[model samples]
Target: MLIDGLQCGHFNRGVFEELRAGAVSCVTITGGFWQGCIESLDAITRWRDLARENADLVVLVRDAEDIDRARAEGKTAIIVGFQNTNLFDSRIRFVELFQDLGVRVVQLTYNNQNEYGGSCYEPEDSGLSRAGKVMVREMNEHGILIDLSHVGELTSQQVIEHSDKPVAITHANPASVIPHKRNKTDKTLALLKERRGIIGCASYRNICAPEHAESAEKWAEIVARTVDLVGIDHVGIGTDRSHGHTLADMHWMRMGRWTREIDYGAGSPENPGTTAPLDWFTEVRHIGRIPGALGNIGFSPDEVEAICFGNWRRVYGEVFPGGK
Candidate 1:
């Protein structure tokens, strides 16, 4: 079974059915990005509606048992997760509230600095404030997995050092592979492995060089290298699929009230709002390409299974309450 470790897509019945057809057992849906508490609530409500309206194809996840049941029924489980806690906004207590509301993962910062810490894009990276430290403990206590996908280097390091439990950089590539700003560094990856943490290699093209934009073969090689570097037990795919979204949605994701000026987030000023997903991974049904390619690249059957599914399930079990 496949588990997309992180996703921010335009969901609909077609997408849900594609996941089922692709044998995706679960998808950790993005519950909040730059949106606030009220907006977050609205998004959650919409996801609830998706689960209700499409019960035959998809269901919302509240615990690990939900994943197992969904898999058994050949339905995809949608686990609510936050890419950033901008919604929690000034209330430490909201962390627990959101957890109760079914948020299983959260990143402390986004592309820019927040009240808690600096972003990966910020010019000056403030590691973590006193409040951010509080959040680390709060999330650990409340069972919300701490994610460092778009956090600044110092903040990510601090998070790895501070958290008593293992944390995840859920949808980031290794900087060693692509050398992008959002990718994790060698030191951070090593520390995370030492602490028994999880890291999911992303397939977003901005993390890769321009020439390899549509290469699934290269994407598979990237995943294999990640496993070789971090060990298969600690790696999986957080492919960052954004299928079926329009320019308006991309603008909101890139600009997000933080700026009035337009920013070409994916490095193509000529093509402002587009992200390049590999040709073979443009949809959920194409997920088999990565794992299939791994089998040809010297991974044993057990190791391929671990990279595609078992590894993520193991991490979810360790971090989320009742996780399988």
Candidate 2:
């Protein structure tokens, strides 16, 4: 029962089949990035439609039991999530509406700041505003898991202290490992653990050191080091594996209506596009290889299971309403 904490791959019957092939019991895939209310609704509707169209291959996950049911039925469970809080459009009550529409996880910010707070790329780090605080409590009341994968450090720290629920850093590595702005600092990781939260080891190559991108063993070492920092129970996999989208779509992800000039994002002028794929994690089905890499790194079978599945299951069960 492997539960991937985050993915943003192209959704299709083929992708769903690949998820089954990977034996991924549940996956929290991105539904919206910088989309506002209307666009976000369209994204959610598309996902719902895809689940209906491919009922034999997948089931929509509203709770942890749905994941168990999908595994028992030999199907993959799809958990819809957003990479930004823009879907709310500053209307707090819409959180419940989106949750009803099958959204379970939401990140507070993307690469840029919005109504909620500052982002990783923003120059200022004002932390959470009063409305951001209200939004946190509202999400808590409605059982939406708060993800701070791309949020600014100051903002993320404030959220960890304020959110009643245990938040998630759904797709990031440690700054101590790679020293990237997108990665979390050791202090942030410590606060997350203290709050009983979990951090998913992001497999995006840019988040990792360049020299180690192609080595599965080195990637597993990152996971191990993260576990060493925040206990095994608070770590899991977030394969930021994206597929089926064109370079234009990728650009949209990087500069979503915010800039006129091209934003290279993690790439530079010499390589101004998506990061090269990690050799061990280019496709969704490649996740099946992760457990072996963990085992090779001296993780016990039970410990490997916790990293690949149990830890995420515990977080989902605790965060989702009626999941426990």
Candidate 3:
């Protein structure tokens, strides 16, 4: 099980235990997204407490060495990451502190303009702000992997060109494969490759643009298209799964001006009617269903492995070595 990116807080104790007991190999756990500096730090403190209690099942991985060691010891490696840069709060030095706490990946913004850059949902994507350039440089200097998944196209391109190190669009689809603002265009995919970046294909229903409520099979089709455009080597998995939450949570996410206006309507229906309640544990199972779906796309085990975990491991090794 290639544990793609997800929020650490989404899982309850039971779900966490189940995942640890499952065949999961590793996971990039998100700690920050739409959080301010103080709140982000507090979240990490909570993670620290969880890590202490779940030491046997969870090992906080700071670098490549830790990942290898965890695999050898039959433990799940947790790659720390931030889904957004709201924690930065216009302070570049915060990057060093988060890096010290084992954060390896960070997206510049969530769904609106920030000190760093414009979000994909932003109406006017003027590009990365002046502060954003400094933040990019700071991230590069500290060796933290930058993510462009929720960033606007112009801002994404600018960051790619500005950063000395390779960045990742941790979770996105191919625009040609599924046309959506969240999906990356063919041109952006090519540019990322040119800059030595990777694209983690997401399994989110919204990103895949399911017709009504489709099966996980829809996600596999999106991945197949991503692999076609960027090839197996440049592609990887980042499920963007928000388990332990429901359509209400989805509505909460849409409350953001950018996400609300663009993704969801002005307000979620007062009553969601009778939509099936979400099962957090099923998220992992849904991702595991992808390989079978890929078989329909003519992908072999080798290609599947690359998309599942190998590519991410390779990139993680390059970005963080010696577990630091």
Clash totals for all models, in order? 0, 0, 0
For candidate 3, give the lDDT of residue 240: 69
User: Residues 23-99, candidate 1, lDDT per residue (tens digit)?
Assistant: 88888888767899999989888988888999989888777778888889988988898888887878999988888
The per-residue C-alpha lDDT of model 1 at residue 200 equals 81
Which candidate tops TM-score?
A: 2
In angstroms, how far off is 95's CA in candidate 1? 1.1
Tens digit of lDDT per residue, candidate 3, span 118-230? 87877888798899899998888776888998898999999989988778988777878777888888888988888778898775555555441365455567677777787
Listed in order, each prediction's TM-score against the native is 0.95, 0.97, 0.86
Worst 10 residues of 1 by lDDT: 209-218
Error of 2 at 124 (Å): 2.3
The C-alpha lDDT values of all candidates are 0.82, 0.88, 0.71
Q: Give the TM-score of candidate 1.
A: 0.95
Residue-wise C-alpha lDDT for candidate 2, range 152-231, written one tens digit per residue:
99999999999887999999999998888889999999999999899999888778886556667778899999999999
* Candidate scoring better on TM-score of 2 and 3: 2
